[model samples]
Target: MIRITKELSFPLENILFSFALKSEAADVFDGHNTLITGIGKVNAAYELSKAIQHKKPSLIVNLGSAGSNYFQKGDVICCSKFIQRDMDVRGLGFEQYETPLSNLPILLEYGFEMEGLQTGICGTGDNFEMGHNTRIYNVVDMEAYALAMIAMKENIPFLCLKYISDGADDNAADDWMIQVHKAAVAYGNILNLNKNNISI
Candidate 1:
């Protein structure tokens, strides 16, 4: 079975419509299933963790948009790892970036191969730092790391599929606005088609 969280629609325009599909399974072949959580951000992770505990689905897939410093627009990134870039305690008085805890190891152990489509660290922050901050992360997003961390704690498998919608610069927000439709289509179709092909 496959489980997709509500955060899946983050990069799409039809958020309400997509959210309507939450808790319901989008029937895919090979026992693959998809679920969505309408709640977003930190709430996304918190809610999704509860959903996963309730369902105990086989795999967790986080599909969304990512901004890049080095990536050009329209690039698809399959994250191998995630990082919490904004969990800075120094300002609050602490140091060290926190890595998300997840059941990714279970997925790997269960034969889910994530071997080099684009291996890089996905930096996470509460804010959308792409257009205004133009941060230099391989991939930047709001929820993946939190989701991963939750999955890790639960010992469930997790994976993130992201499409680069902006370059994480002054134009990042606008760039995403222009390419959002295309990004949504591509991401949805890819999820639809790769229902059983988990070989990375």
Candidate 2:
């Protein structure tokens, strides 16, 4: 088991890097313990949560590609807060995205900082939502919310980093495919910069 302390200077080896797709992490993080969690929230939540329970890394760093109308293509942003955009059960006297009974029902936050990375609000859904957006969330993804929520429940420090691959337009698929590799490389740079942040 890994211990969480006030000091934030752990070796990169103790950090578990996660990716939704292998190609999204290709040529990057070649020698690290990166988790390729398939795609979407179910895969990420089940796999990552299981791993966290078993291995208990000091930190989890989720890196992948995302769609955005505001963030520039190839821009890597840190997800400090996450929300589930696809959950709509307001008819039952609850908010649309609220994860019922949780302390922070609709939102989960990762309390940490990374130098040279801008904190962004990320929204996750099962489907790839194109052109559907809100001003509150700049990044749209498929896995970050589930990953962050699980980490919070497990009391593990989590950081989500994403590269903007598309503009939430019709051309998003093609753009995502083309830019996934680039995003992977950029994610590597962040790991190198903050290698000591993960607890050894």
Candidate 3:
């Protein structure tokens, strides 16, 4: 049970920037309060939880690389809705993507909507989506859902910005390797441009 304080004056100082890998962050977030939560939901949840315990942030901003079929490569998308793509328990009379007996909705909607940015429904899963059969989500990532969940539980404002590194196809691995390094630059530009305009 981490307590959040509303005394922070600067917006950037009160923001907790989260990433799944150091490669995704690069040197853009050099001196800021950034957390590299490794990969996947478990790591994302554990690392973010630990960080919040030390100091609760007013806002949790998740910046990462993601694969998408609907959006083009090199596009930066603002995601407000999240889904656990790997959660499937239809066999147990539970709805698809629903957490069994948890009372959580299949699509968890909570995040700041940035102006002039395209919004997307992000599907977070353990597996790297190469085929991407469903139209339910346009963006696919490995950790945003867990981070978003923690932020929701903590009553903290959350924002997720995903850079499209691949097209979620057979060439996704190669494309991701090439485009992932550019995510930091994209995020940096967006933040710098909107730093004064962003309310949360």
Best by lDDT: 3
Cα lDDT of model 1 by residue, 109-186, tens digit: 111224334644677677768453433347887777777776667776666767787887888778766765565456
Q: TM-scores of the models, in the given order?
A: 0.66, 0.88, 0.91
Each candidate: RMSD to true structure? 8.7, 3.9, 5.0
The residue-level lDDT of candidate 1 at 72 comes to 69
- Which runs of model 1 end up more than 4 angstroms from their true locations? 1-33, 38-40, 91-93, 96-116, 131-136, 188-200
lDDT of each: 0.55, 0.79, 0.88
How many times do residue backbones clash in model 1? 10
Global lDDT of model 3? 0.88
Show pairs that collide, candidate 1.
2-33, 6-37, 89-93, 89-94, 90-94, 101-149, 101-152, 102-152, 103-152, 134-168
RMSD of 1: 8.7
Give one digit per residue, the lDDT tens place, for model 2 in 1-200: 12223445556667788899998878556666789999899999999977887778888988899999888998888788888988877888888888667667576676565666777889899988777558767899999998887888888888788899998788888888788778876865655533333322
Best by TM-score: 3
Cα-based lDDT at residue 35, candidate 2: 91
Ranking by TM-score: 3, 2, 1
